[model samples]
Target: MVCINCKLFSQLNKSVDEQKQKIEDMSGLMEEMGKEEFISVFTEELFDALSKMIEEKKLSMENAILLLKRIGYLKTLKRIHYFGFEKISLSERIEKMIINEEEKKEEKNEKLLVGLCECYLLFYSRVPSSEFLSICVPCLLKAALKKEESEKAQKEVEMALLALSNIYMWTNVPKELYLSEIKEVIQYHQEHHNLTHLAYQSVWAFFTDRMFFEKSLEEVGVNELHLVREAVRELEELTKNVIWMREKKDERGKETNEELLLIRWFMTMKIYLRHCQLQNEEFVGLFNSIVQMFRAAKDNFRKISNECMYIFLVAKGNLSIEIEDLLNGGVVDVALEEMQQPTLGYKMMCYNLEIINSISWQLKGKKKDEKEEAKRKATKRKVLEKMEEKGYEDDIFCFNEILDILNEVNFYDEALSLDISDYFVNV
Candidate 1:
């Protein structure tokens, strides 16, 4: 017998229950049906559903938003070539669907504007159409800049940032066109909320590839650019069970959970650090906060270790962090202790060794302040002493890999031994 439980979604209508059920079914449909079959059967219903949500008052705004959210996930399955929809009209009465600037989302609106923003994101690929950017940018900015102390407000901000992230997938977002507002939105979230992964990538790209290198971050008006440190501290509060998370890694990130948030969160920070400089105090505070997170995210140490190398590489003189800053931030202690751990996996070991190598390599470089030479030598001598004992343990089976890394980093082992002391030589 044909079952009601598996009723074909193509037979669905705009009735709230059926629409909701179909929205839920699309996830299964993506897996069960081939890509073309899924698109052919469901694409008409999908856009039609979005149109009904936009044009009709029958579906609750919550369900409408949920429908768009489901579509967003399902879109990942198909490799969309060009988004110029020929048969379907995505832009019909689209401008009227969005709430205008004068219209505050009052008690009566039922989040009508929120659904429209989601709809905007659904049609995001074609947003560059001449009139659409003008219509949508203001609506997005207004929502993006909203700062209220409630759940609903957070949702609006997230929607806007996620949308902005899409608007700015490239490094060359024009400063006056919409980027100034985009920058304001990023700063707003940094103070109040965390950005979504997509948003973080754009933010990273924006800052790392700043159009004018001579202009400081302050010059660009990201004067309160404590986003990275704030995000790191926020992570410290949210994280505890890295191993629990890793076990469900495949299942996680579908809803962009804590682990995925962290990976993207630091990408934004690392990208900024890669091309720009932070103040000495801020840089030290940021590194220490990362150390705190490293301590907290115990099982995810490998992830942290991989990211931490970027910070160390900055000391090779992106001009923000220095070797002494890393040393002061207790980097030496962490590397020495972690490198000796018998439990460390390959990537984790490589990261720890890289950290040690970066520190040693930078420490051996010439310092401009000739007066500080004696103190620098003393510091290097002390670090070498620790590495002498703890750097390379006897348990390593990855000898060739280790040797290869040694050669690449140009380890100065004039001592003619491949011991841990090989990390520094001649200096």
Candidate 2:
């Protein structure tokens, strides 16, 4: 499992490195060509390089700007001229082009690259605006779904989709486009489960973010009620169905298969929890089930992608009542046992416990009455030390689970469903 994960991450890194090398190689060729030849060749090469960079997710906004400058494809002055403003204006040009298409096809292509470059830049910076996303996302979506689009174009579109989903929480585009694309992605996954999981991962990011619903989803008639109803139904059905293999398998094989299954279940849990939180229905029941699922998988170290799954679960819990339940459910014992094998989840749990302890200590000084405060501090210290002795201090997942216990014990205010930051991956 570790090897496979390493291999997967390595491939992602290698792909990025390859794109970086291509941009570097192309930039070197720029000064050798004559001006006219450079413009034509640069245009061709820029399209190819940026296309690959975007597809591979190796492109950053700074990189895009740097690449354009290195190749002398367009003067920064011309880009500023087209956008009619300064401060990263690629999306601005896209907005203009979409609104008024007076440019020739060649200019339009250049504008598209600029637009894509800006979109990517906005995402990497972790800040975005509605106008910027609206200008570029619709075009990218159209390009991705266009049957006549070439393979290279499609790959760029996919990269754009992934980035769009990531920063989508910051912007508000039309929901119709997002919904349509998401539905298509779901259908594609249903047919081809072994295909790349990027698209699959992106759906979660789109759904979890609050901006998507407040800005775009309502316009698209996404029917939050319908999604909630479907999620509830799906969760219940999935919870009931489990494959039991009687044939004996070695530890590694068993662990690997179980981890995969839990990951899928975790995806379902995310959907159900997000929908429940969105609808403002009672989220307790949904969260309760999620806790149960994690508990069910608790004993299986070999069969778990512990850290990532723990991150998902902890992020979902996020100071909610679910955190309390996790603690009260004997997280220390389960985590300790799981830690003997040291799954990633167990390590994360330890970190989470540490955070909670730190927070609790900081909040203690604010309390009145030194004696009462000291007593409270002592109790909190006991829990913290116990967790430490059990080898959980460094694991965030452990701290999160401890917080869950405290929540269950009614130490803090009851949880209110907060804005679901849809940036989190669903599965």
Candidate 3:
């Protein structure tokens, strides 16, 4: 056993070294090509190598985490999807490390603990092991709660909060663990310029998790309607901050970081809107914000527009929102315009079809007389006419497939019924 462990450690160290060297070599290239482009180009190669190492059982959780630390958090997150890191026994290993740390209480390694938390976060989509979370969550909470006033302590707290955010993305973090600390995390994010985005992400994740929202409402013994109204107010503040950042001019013409932050903000708001009932004015305001974003966003960020459209369609179906309301927001017009774009992908084409089918069904239900019925037919015809006029007739097959799908499935009902996990994947 001792020899086996030694061999594993040696192999893990070598793997980490190799990954570190690769990252160093890619640094110049990363600068020349943006991080996103670089990651897209090399993701397959990186994933293949990491997957092989894991499959061979040559990379232990400890070393895998060390490798992530070397590569940095964002890159590690992008690479892990290809690495299939979720298939490994990371939670068990991290749990063991936590136990060891507890045993050596006087010699605490905050860095290692933070790394373990980060690793667990990277695989958060997989539903991190309960044992690991039970241990790590409290450890992180404690670290975050420590009242050290030094810069090092502040950095450590930021890392812990980030880990907590990642944890909240999947699991319901207990109120006791976070209720006190979350305020501090938010304040730190507001006050600290360096890691504000990370802080905002953590807070957004915490607030948007269904479990957290429901639990908080229950704990406060407040009517969900009242609680949701308050929550919406907080979300508006968060959105305002993100929008302010996005409005600021940057030399690059496009601010990728700000745009991403805005996307995440909208995503969180979508979650809240889905899970909670809102006042009519609140709902309309939120819906309008989504449409405005869809209109203002660049073509490169079509996913944001797609997500906004999905949310609108889902709301229209589930909330019994009127066709007139949708038309007033120019939802139909926007859907037609998006569908006519030649560069739209197969997935987006499917999405646009879903939106059109949703509106068509709503209009059908609202038709009480021949005049209204005629209007519905004309509306559907207008969509087809617009498509033809925009030269989307070349993709007539896709349009026909969409009609068939509408016949088979109710898009809004199907979408609203899906897990948040499903919605976030395309986003």
Candidate 4:
């Protein structure tokens, strides 16, 4: 047992090191090539490489999942910035090809479908996502609703829901595109037992803070009063005594887990609670589930990835309710201690910068209660202390947009969704 654990730990570290080195190497090359030439070459190469892999059926399921996450992370990188992406003709070509592959497939190529959903997010800025979304939305819904019970099938369903959740979360999806299916979507699980716990979270997350169609949802007889309560109930069960320590194994241990889905879920949850209009009774019930997650995280050595989530949600959450629960549950102590160590990846690094910016903003809001205002200033001081606690510092995280948040003063009144586009991957 000890040897097996050692092997897994060693492999995890090796993968993290390789990813860090990849970022360092890419940064060096991009500097030499300059942004314009670099993006052009990178874009052309990506389409060329993926085309061959898909054509020859060389995209194994394992590689396909990795590719989806890689592309998603790569999309977040500034060097591969989307501004220049629109100028390139191949941007549209690649986007169309991803969708076309899904359209023409005889059997559902789960790999391709997964890739297509993530790729939609990758090129949403460059591609006309509206038209393609019109087609993909219903198709993805059909895929999610299928009754396949195999392990592979269940994973596909989970990924499909994850894709939908992310698409809705990041993109300002047009109401017309998915509004017709709103009632059916929220009500699907009520009648069926096909969705996983994660899937349920993902679907409810799809509607989080999307007020553009709230009236439309209500018009279709979707009851939010019931939906929010049920979601909270399930969350209570899913999180009971759950430890946010290890990545859940997938594909029979061939892979650990995709961090992006969980990250996306946290993002959705912050907004979900805000818009759910949590009833007094449900608020405490829902928060009890959240409190346990933090207790578990702190008890388990504050795993780096999950730690990112704690800070991410803390800084991003609007109301005092969610933030107070997290802080009181020991997120503050663990987050302060864990942050002193180096981060694992560019995503983790971006999140670190994000947490500082988000929390530091807490110091700037108006004085409501004298005690409350002093508490806000104190929170800022603690974050600043931990940031410099490690000693050596020199703008190691080069996120100009992120770092700028520290110096700015803004009121944290309403729960605002932070701009995710500002985040980057292996820069």
Identify the leading candidate in terms of TM-score: 1
lDDT: which is higher, 2 or 4? Answer: 4
lDDT over C-alpha atoms for residue 192 of model 4: 69
**Which residue pairs in candidate 4 have backbone atoms (N, alpha carbon, C) closer than 3 angstroms, thus clashing?**
none
What C-alpha lDDT, on a 0 to 100 scale, does residue 370 get in candidate 4?
92
- lDDT of all predictions: 0.53, 0.42, 0.53, 0.48
1 against 4, candidate with superior lDDT: 1
* TM-score order of candidates, top first: 1, 3, 4, 2
Which candidate model has the greater lDDT, 3 or 4? 3
Q: Which runs of model 4 end up more than 4 angstroms from their true locations?
A: 1-46, 52-91, 97-128, 168-170, 180-182, 212-222, 225-227, 230-263, 276-280, 299-427
Which scores greater on TM-score, model 1 or model 4? 1
Error of 4 at 91 (Å): 4.5
lDDT (Cα) of model 4:
0.48
- TM-score of predicted structure 4: 0.48
- List residue ranges in candidate 1 displaced over 4 A: 1-11, 16-66, 73-137, 167-169, 177-215, 218-223, 240-256, 298-319, 371-379, 389-402, 405-422, 425-427
lDDT of 1 by residue, 1-427 (tens): 1232235434445677877777677556454544455455545545665556456565555665675555553443233333333245544444445535225555535346545655565445643543555555555666656657576666566655555444433333344545566567667666655554444444433444443343455335334555555555655654553453343433322322555556655655655665555444556666676676666555644555556644544444454466666666766667667766667655555555556655666577667888677767877877766656664434233443465554555433321125555455234
Q: Tell me how candidate 2 scores on lDDT.
A: 0.42
List runs of model 3 lying over 4 Å from the truth.
1-67, 70-72, 75-82, 86-93, 103-107, 142-158, 168-172, 187-195, 210-255, 278-281, 298-300, 317-333, 336-402, 405-427
- The residue-by-residue lDDT of candidate 3 on 1-427, one tens digit each, is 3342232233343455675564455444333444454344434345455546655766654556655543444543232234344444544555566667656858788667767776566545456666666667777767766566677666666566656655544565556655555556444544543344544554555556634445453333123223334334444454454443244434433334545555555555556545544334444445555666677653545556667776665665555354555655666667767777767665555566556555545544546789868876665565555545655444444565354444345433344212222211111
lDDT (10s digit) by residue, model 2, range 1-427? 3342232222323344564565566544443333344333423333444445545666654455445434322221011112212233443433454445323554466445544443443223334455555645565555445333455555454454554444534455556546666556555544544223333344444555544345444322234323333333444554454433332244323222233334544543454343432332334344444445555544544233343335334433443223333344444344444444443443443433333443343434434888756755665555566556765544434334344444444322233112121111110
C-alpha root-mean-square deviation, candidate 3: 10.3
